[model samples]
Target: MRKAAALGVAALALAAQCAAAAVPVQGYAIKATYPHDPQAFTQGLFFKDGFLWESTGQYGASSVRKVELATGKVLQKRALPEKVFGEGIAPHGDSIVGITWMNQAGFVMDQGSLSIKGTFNYMGEGWGLTSDGERLYMSDGTPEIRVLDPKSFGEQRRIKVTVDGQPLAKINELEWVEGQIYANVWQSDRIARIDPFSGRVLGWIDLSGLAATAKAGKDIDNVLNGIAYDAKTRRLFVTGKRWPKLFEIELRPAKK
Candidate 1:
């Protein structure tokens, strides 16, 4: 088993090396600014039907909410059980799927009513969750992104994330954008753009110092945790927990 895993990793590393030379991403300036709550601990962010939805973490504070983009007003919210630590979230049609930290439980909620519809079990603590219109992609604060059948929520395949032949660890929040998976490195400001086919890190979206503008307040969630992309409009939205504003920035290829 170890030998097979080693060989698989070696093959992926070689593929990353070949793709690294072609990866071109230049950072762009902030395009738009939106309202963000300074008291919400944003764990996951997604855009659906012109509304922005956020899932917050922490034990007692865990919640899923739908908010107006311009006003920062919560349209609907449902709290998690006191024992479950909420994590990432993704949208599926009219329903929302949420993962729980250390609980191994995932919930499917009514998209319009915001009520729990069903639940499933996972093997590891759920950290980040996203989908590719078909299968669900999840992270457990590890390098691998586990693909699961959306209906069953069971593991189908797994791919370890790497960039330029180096393993990228602590992959937290994930967003599937244009056939690629973008992930935030936990406790860090940068988000890596990964190749899902081979789990190679093509490049990184550096958010180092991006959170400097946010003033820390009492009981504020400090770590950056929100990421959402609008596919139809091609806009990327990002914000940290308890942040005062949501930034829509364009990605420009970093100069070598």
Candidate 2:
């Protein structure tokens, strides 16, 4: 009888510990208006020199496009061959780096002319990609980030991702901003802010209930992907391929 009581107490204590370990919600605020889109399924996105560049995906449906933010108009578009499906994209100095899903090839394109400059190879499947001025970060649908040498396109190191003792996997659509990595959880409406050095999730940006928004009612992408940051303007852009609109959001702490 005494042992049973002791076990019960221990189980209660563990439950209390788990409740205490839950990450707290601080607060939240919206910075700007949400943009609208007609076609969803955004695969890759990046902001460079006041322009928003995007890529869409599927087996045979993929493209790279430059969009005007205020108007949601495609200023320029270059469709990928049906054989090459597009993934995430980022800016490396004056050039744009884009990845091809399943093709194992990535391209460095000229920003002004939209011409391909070079191609490089990487191991595993490329799902999402981004750059942090110096090093390139990639996701292979794993709970880790593989740092690549920009020049050689070779692996430098990898760090596992976790938040509050929970492993966060299926990370897609990556963006590096202000020394941190931001990733979209595949097939969900949540974004995780991760530490670049330790791979710990610092915070989470819950995009819950976003699928029911007015724009989502029109032409919602099946899944969410793509994130981009504008350094000069401090703007964060998010979208999915075939999504009706891209959003420029200002994130605040969740409510307490």
Candidate 3:
């Protein structure tokens, strides 16, 4: 009887340790605010060389815009062909690449001119994109992230994201921040911070009340999306679809 009791205690201790290994959910504190185009249905966002590059979706209104970080002024803009719905944008070498939803095509543009350089074809839907300077990380609205060669636009590898051993789906707009891949979960106020190599979710950033704080009466799609990190300034920014305000947020560890 004593041996059985000892074995049961060991089992309980092992279970407790396994439970402790689960990742924690976190929240954010707004450090600053910036004016964003209220009409912009942001699907992807990134910062480079002091400018904010944004991609907006919707069949006819899909566009890529380089905006002034502070004033929300569009410095340059290029509209995608009306038939394609824009999804994600990433800096590739001296150029930029933007992907389309459902079209399986991606556009390469000259960074300075924002003019289409060419289009490349891919297999699945493109939901989010980001570059780690060497390779492109892409999400297809599933739990998997594909690593592609920036030059050939060919898939090199894939990572299946999971939180505490459970698959995480609906991964949306992505930004590679401080060596971690940050992705917005579609239709949710949570953002998953994932390990690039292991695909294990390290933590979650919950911005639950953010959209409610938007300008009253402004029309919005009400989904939390879009993440951009300024490596030069080490600033993190987030905005939602059709949200008028952009926020720079600081992460806070959630309580146990």
Best-fitting candidate, measured by TM-score? 3
130-224, model 2: which lDDT tens digit per residue? Answer: 88889999988989888988888899999799876667899999998888998988877778888989998877787765455424554334655
Candidate 1 per-residue lDDT over residues 37-143, each given as its tens digit: 88787888888899998999888989999999888889899999999899999988778999998998999999888899999998877988888888889999888
The CA lDDT at 5 in model 2 is 100
Off by over 4 Å in 1: 1-25, 216-221
The global C-alpha lDDT for each of the candidates, from Candidate 1 onward, is 0.84, 0.78, 0.90
Question: What is the Cα-based lDDT of residue 126 in candidate 2?
Answer: 88
Model 1 worst lDDT run, 10 consecutive residues: 212-221
The local distance difference test score of model 3 is: 0.90
lDDT of 3 at 55: 98
The RMSD of every model to the true structure, in order and in angstroms, is 6.4, 2.9, 3.9
Model 2 misplaced regions, further than 4 Å: 1-30, 34-37, 217-221
Question: Clashes in model 3: which pairs?
Answer: none
